[model samples]
Target: MQPYRPSPSPARRTVLRGSLAASAAVSLGARPAPAQARSGRPRAAWGVQTGDVTSSSGLVWVRSDRPARMVVETSATESFRRPRRWEGPLLGPDTDCTGTTALRGLPPGTQIHYRVTLADPDDPRRTGEPVYGTFRTAPARRRDGVRFLWSGDIAGQGWGINPDIGGFRAYEEMRRLDPDFFLCSGDTVYADGPLLPSVTLPDGRVWRNLMTEEKAKVAETLDEYRGVFRYNLLDHNVRAFNAQVPSIVQWDDHEVRNNWYPGQILDDPRYGEKDVDVLAARAGRAFGEYFPVRAPSAGRIHRVVRHGPLLDVFVLDMRTYRNANSPGRQADDTTGILGTEQLAWLKRELARSRAVWKVLAADMPLGLVVPDGAVDFEAVAQGDPGVPLGRELQIAELLRFIKHRRITGTLWLTADVHYTSAQHYLPERAAFQDFAPFWEFVSGPLAAGGFPANALDGTFGPERVFVRAPQRANVSPMESPQYFGEVDIDGDSGELTVRLRAEGGTVLFSQVLRPGRVGQ
Candidate 1:
């Protein structure tokens, strides 16, 4: 079959055209397979997932092999003899046969067992196999404790699904820890990464990737972008992990392409088209369709997830609102990393939050310098050592606002550097002393190529307390180390502990912090 070619015209860049909508409508009324004696088997292609858990509500997601109606039966008991059934949206070709159901009015701080059933659209009696998953609702008040894991950069740099050893082993280890939820910081899929069938390792061993057509090249069309997401589900470990643990997901540059910004023209010769906005639109739509997340206002993915009085996670959308990567830095520069509106929203949320610990779940680090190319950079810091410039100015202002507002017990967690490390930022060492001292933990490459740490931008005065990574770049998972970080907030003492663990679940570094003691 010939690859689908999308028109690169500016007029057609706003929306995805062609057979997408028509096929979606036709799929809605499509007939299901004929019922057989054993038709009750579950057919969840991507397994079951529950996310965005609140005091009274949560989101459940599943995908079917064909057009079907998603039905979720929930109960407090594992047996689920008298479970309550909730109907989900239609699973059709429009959303690539994926659907998410909002499970609302759930009891706070209670474990809810759910079984997902995908019934044939034509014959409701003929259902696929049922998949079981579980999630705990957020507490209504301060409770015993809260534990969650966080990481990013999955299936990137030729590190694709390996059928021999399940998928990403880190996920298996994380599931063993059994945290309340998983914060997928960013780089959920490398839309621009190409995966080959096989490659020769440095030790003469053959490393194989479970290949698919969409992952063969850079994602361009809607199908190719959807394929990128589907490729990750090929890993049984990932599917199993998603089923058990709820995921709070966000996106960085790799979902569309590395170091991409809105309105930027593609200069890479590998892509036949030049406009990046069209590709981003397709990628964003696919991301929304696949993940079990609430639609954000104005299409921005940045939002807050409050877990009672113990914790409040602020998931930042660093990719959506940003300025073009350039060399210039001025105090009065209107262009920034968080943009104007997002920056303001963050401040308002921080001030209004009543949780004991305000965790800034950021996609990118505040101080690390991620250079896009020879003259451009991707994150807040632009490699300028001393003074705040350009994007750094925005970060400086936000940090200053946190200090001015007297927001205590705030921490930043990120995972784009592909390694694990604990960094301490002190006001005494910083050029700008208006901000309070805080710790930022970084870990990941959950199943991607591992690389050495990037240089720190001295604007924030980050001191590396601990660093664990290979000296070389793009090392395979078998040869290199992978890491994930976990946060434990104690209900009784109100103490927060951060742990950075390796692939085998070994705690490489740990730190304990208490409220009101920051910067002391």
Candidate 2:
């Protein structure tokens, strides 16, 4: 992945008072310190994580204290010793001060412990706090079955009381099940619009001022996005859980600006030149800084990751490269949905895929039908289906691609809709059978704030199965404010079980989505 090289904009120091104040105040045992909270070196942090148990490789990342070379270590245990190792230099700010090291020649499915050490130019004792973490590789390519988790939209406001509303509980419950790795469907952080003025909590006093409403109505900006991300990452449980497993992420509306269509800069009347561009760039920069992704391809938001033969995950960028949002636009069927090039790429990958299962991950629902019995592409944008023919052609191309490919073992995961539910759709074959069989698991709001209901039955047409959790299932007992999804594949039996769990440790729903096995 190449580093970003945009012209430097004025760096905005994020206001830590509302989001990071408590942590800083407790750490310093004082009211507050200006940007320089501590007197020494900057504290270490990590973000945007993913990994695979390659036949002979593994990867790791951490934020740098300065532009210096980093040493990456892997061991069978936390105690570093005669285990395998790799080292690399994080060239410059292009990396946004984050370092990625790919270590090679490791055993498969090995629970190798790892950490990064910062080396200084002059100091003899240049090092970091071991930065302890762990990851395992994929099973042999021919391995029969494998399991992983997937979910999205985990966040609350930067200053809200119940920050855990965005699936913080889901993170804790997921730790107990401990799947191979997790999939962040989309909307990992709602950077919303620009950074607004955070209500100052000076002297721990909550003000009931009318100005708060005035600030709320203002447009979104870069600072707001950064503050939201900073606030979310501050959660200790989220950080700890991520340290143990690799998480693959793709962004949705909230990451940039809400309900944003390509070229539509949120509420900007000036279009391209508005604050939307600035905010988008900032959110992307922050996402790069905090997440472990292989950079966006050609300004198009899409990429594919292979987890050996067990699964092939396609992460798509639905926001970028989208046609402008409006009514009566021209229909260039060749360029919508996945765009001609990206759609072609996706089709080629699907045809060539030898993995047991293929997971298509998008930020929004693919087959979502609205109240009027029509696919509402512009529900967020109101009645204007903008360039209706173009959008429909895009949908047609995708449907044709899926049907022609006979792509079984393909499951869909999405976020941005704060709910936990799923439905199976099959557009191929003469008759439209309810059990035609392809599942879509939707999870969001790590700390859910919106109302959730039976979205499964509501979205995917009238007839859909709503499975109940089995009695005596060995599930967690804690109450979860956030929601998430999980899938477990038993290689020996070829059984892939998927489930949605609430923060309260209760299994909201579960289904054994058995691929390769039909009927009794």
Clashes of each: 4, 32
CA RMSD per model (angstroms): 10.0, 10.0
Model 1 alpha-carbon drift over 4 Å, by segment: 1-42, 296-298, 518-520
Provide the overall lDDT of each model, using Cα atoms, as 2-decimal numbers: 0.81, 0.54
Name the runs in model 2 displaced over 4 angstroms: 1-42, 45-56, 65-68, 91-96, 122-124, 141-144, 157-167, 193-227, 266-275, 296-301, 326-332, 369-392, 428-437, 452-462, 467-480, 517-520
Error of 2 at 449 (Å): 1.5
Clashing pairs in 1: 41-128, 41-129, 42-128, 42-129
lDDT of 1 by residue, 392-454 (tens): 888888999998898888999999989988889988887777888999999998999999988
Candidate 2 lDDT score at position 457: 20
Could you say which candidate leads in TM-score? 1
Candidate 2 lDDT tens digits, 296-391: 322345777777767788887777656544441345646665566777888888888877777888877654431212443432122332222545
Top candidate by lDDT: 1
User: Lowest-scoring 10 consecutive residues by lDDT in candidate 2?
Assistant: 8-17
